[model samples]
Target: MKEGRRVYGAEDDDPPGPQPGHEYVELVGGALDGQLLDVTSWAGEDREGGAMLITENGLHGPGGRADYEPRPGTPDKWDWQGDYP
Candidate 1:
């Protein structure tokens, strides 16, 4: 396994919580709704700190609830938005 990478527990194992070196992410708009925002420092679980908001304009960081609204009728999918440098 890679360094700082977190592994999810098996079906019979306990759930892994708040992993170190791991940041939770979520997509806000576009075709990739409810997807993981792979863009580093772009978006994350608010509980972790704050989530970045991405739009047709560009990437915004440390955003709050008032930042952007998610699109309706988008299915929650685990899709990769792409990697960040």
Candidate 2:
């Protein structure tokens, strides 16, 4: 999926991704009561930012053992949050 480039505050030409002064929230996928996640990235960052909703969970993707399941109990372990700005 593609999202429109957004700029917050003084950054009128900021690129897509997480920005220090900017904040973004996206609903990944989950049931009404199930866990929901949001992925975000700053304007000057290559890595994406993520957070868990409904539950204090974590984000995981790629780089894992032979078996990998995108679930709460079977997370792959990733550090989406970073210091930028």
Candidate 3:
């Protein structure tokens, strides 16, 4: 729930919601496949973010997109190629 924390699944316990200047990643699958969301809020069952389409190139969102590769030895860290939007 703290800002900049990476959450793997919905079943996992929600952390503190995102704070100002904080970015949160939610790995969504099953019903929402190939999608990673920027967690804006996690109040109860409500979850929201600026939707990003996960592609071979990278995570694409409105207004901006970046090429990201999974960091070695760190599943939570992504190597962002280009400026992070």
Model 1, C-alpha of 31: deviation from truth (Å): 0.5
Local distance difference test, per candidate? Answer: 0.34, 0.29, 0.39
Pairing residues by index, what is the TM-score of model 3?
0.28
**Best-fitting candidate, scored by lDDT:** 3
TM-score of candidate 2 to 2 decimals: 0.18
Residue 48 alpha-carbon offset, candidate 3, angstroms: 23
Return the TM-score for each candidate structure. Answer: 0.22, 0.18, 0.28
Among the numbered candidates, top TM-score falls to 3
**lDDT (C-alpha) at residue 18 in model 1:** 29
Candidate 3 residue spans exceeding 4 A from truth:
1-62, 83-85
* lDDT at 3, model 3: 43
RMSD vs true structure, all candidates: 12.2, 13.4, 12.4
lDDT of 2 by residue, 2-83 (tens): 2453322224555554444433433323221221222333332322323322222222222211111233443323322212
Candidate 1: 10-residue stretch with minimal lDDT: 1-10
Clashing pairs in 1: none
Models sorted by TM-score, best on top: 3, 1, 2
The superposed Cα distance between candidate 3 and the true structure at residue 8, in angstroms, equals 13
* TM value for model 1: 0.22
Tens-place lDDT digits, model 1, residues 6-70: 22221335343324454444444433344343323444353233233333333332221213233
